[model samples]
Target: MRDFIGRAMMTLYFTVCATLKSGAMIVALRDPTWSWARGISVAADVAALGFLVLIVATTVARLPPVKTAQGIEPRLSALIGCFATVTLIAVPGVQTLPQLELVADLITIVGFTLCIWCLWWLGRSFSITAQARRLVTAGPYQLVRHPLYACEAVVLFGIVLRNPTWAVVAIGAIVICFQCRRIINEEKVLRSAFPEYDAYARATPILIPSISTLRELVFPGAR
Candidate 1:
């Protein structure tokens, strides 16, 4: 069937991507040039690798969606946003202050860890395209509607910081634009599929969490 083929292809795509990236990172970590910066970078790579493996696993195990966007645009947006940052790997690293690179590595490590947490909550609902599998409103989703994408944005920003080049910045900006489009398309699909999604969106911020939102999440009685 066509649907079965699509799912198989998707699984293959994610599997190849995760395997290659993880292998490269593992090899890099094995290099004998150990330093504080390298250690931090290794941590970031490990977190990133974990996230990638999770993505492949979730993609293979995710539930069937109730509704899927019915256009080429949504698929294109999702694919672009998902893979855009990969170009940064080819960009030459710039010579920067060791402290600055270390800060960027720390930021990526934190972002990737949060991303993994978000993905854990997403679980069976994960999809590369705009599709509504189930209404997830727990964990990081309680604070922000698209916490996964927000965390990914953090990782992308950290990568840009690590490789401060005009091409990197331009690609980052383009990727962000596509990511925004992907978010919009996903919201539309979710709202169409779930009647309660509108109310949830109203209560939760889209990407950024405010101070009041943090307080409410911490102390539910405050609301």
Candidate 2:
């Protein structure tokens, strides 16, 4: 029952973020007087919404109903923190929208693509509950250890660049910190549950992609 509730809460959280971001995007795109910041916001919003949908659908489809927990779970707190940080980013700040630049557009496009790739990599392996069921070494995992989070970081960095406000930057930083904490905690759990996880960690980079690692993953015999 606890696990079920946690999963439900997580779903609700992602749904709310997705809805908020989508609404913000619609507003940005439809407004004739949209500023540069507004346009960037619109891109970020769309990317976030699309990512959330992918994450939620993939997660719920593979994971079984979570059993209810008896007490507060650390993962729940981390989840809430993540939600809060993302919400802060979605909210508009005091800065006026900057003028649109070609470089910014290219960055945003790349960021969006990375997020999509991250979601694709995380397919069927995503979960909200505080349990480590399996060590996924296929797909994106074969490329990087935490591709989803890495992609998100890239996307958020692009968003920050588009709207170089202190608020947005701070929010992005907080979100990164939250993700890092979650990653650390999750790694601890995974290491304990799966003995081979440590070995995998030794060979794989956590977030950043390396050409050599990519080669090794793609061509096992080359390494």
Q: Write the per-residue lDDT of candidate 1 for residues 131-220, one digit (tens) a residue.
A: 999999999998899999899888888889998878888889989999999999999999999999999999999999888989876898
Best by lDDT: 1
User: In lDDT terms, how accurate is model 2?
Assistant: 0.65
- 173-198 in candidate 2: lDDT tens per residue? 77787788767666776777778888
| Index of the highest-TM-score prediction | 1
TM-score of each: 0.91, 0.76
Count of clashing residue pairs in every prediction: 0, 9
The superposed Cα distance between candidate 2 and the true structure at residue 105, in angstroms, equals 4.9
Q: Clashing residue pairs in candidate 2, if any?
A: 1-67, 1-68, 2-68, 2-69, 3-67, 3-68, 4-66, 37-97, 37-98
Stretches of candidate 1 exceeding 4 Å from the true structure: 86-95, 219-223
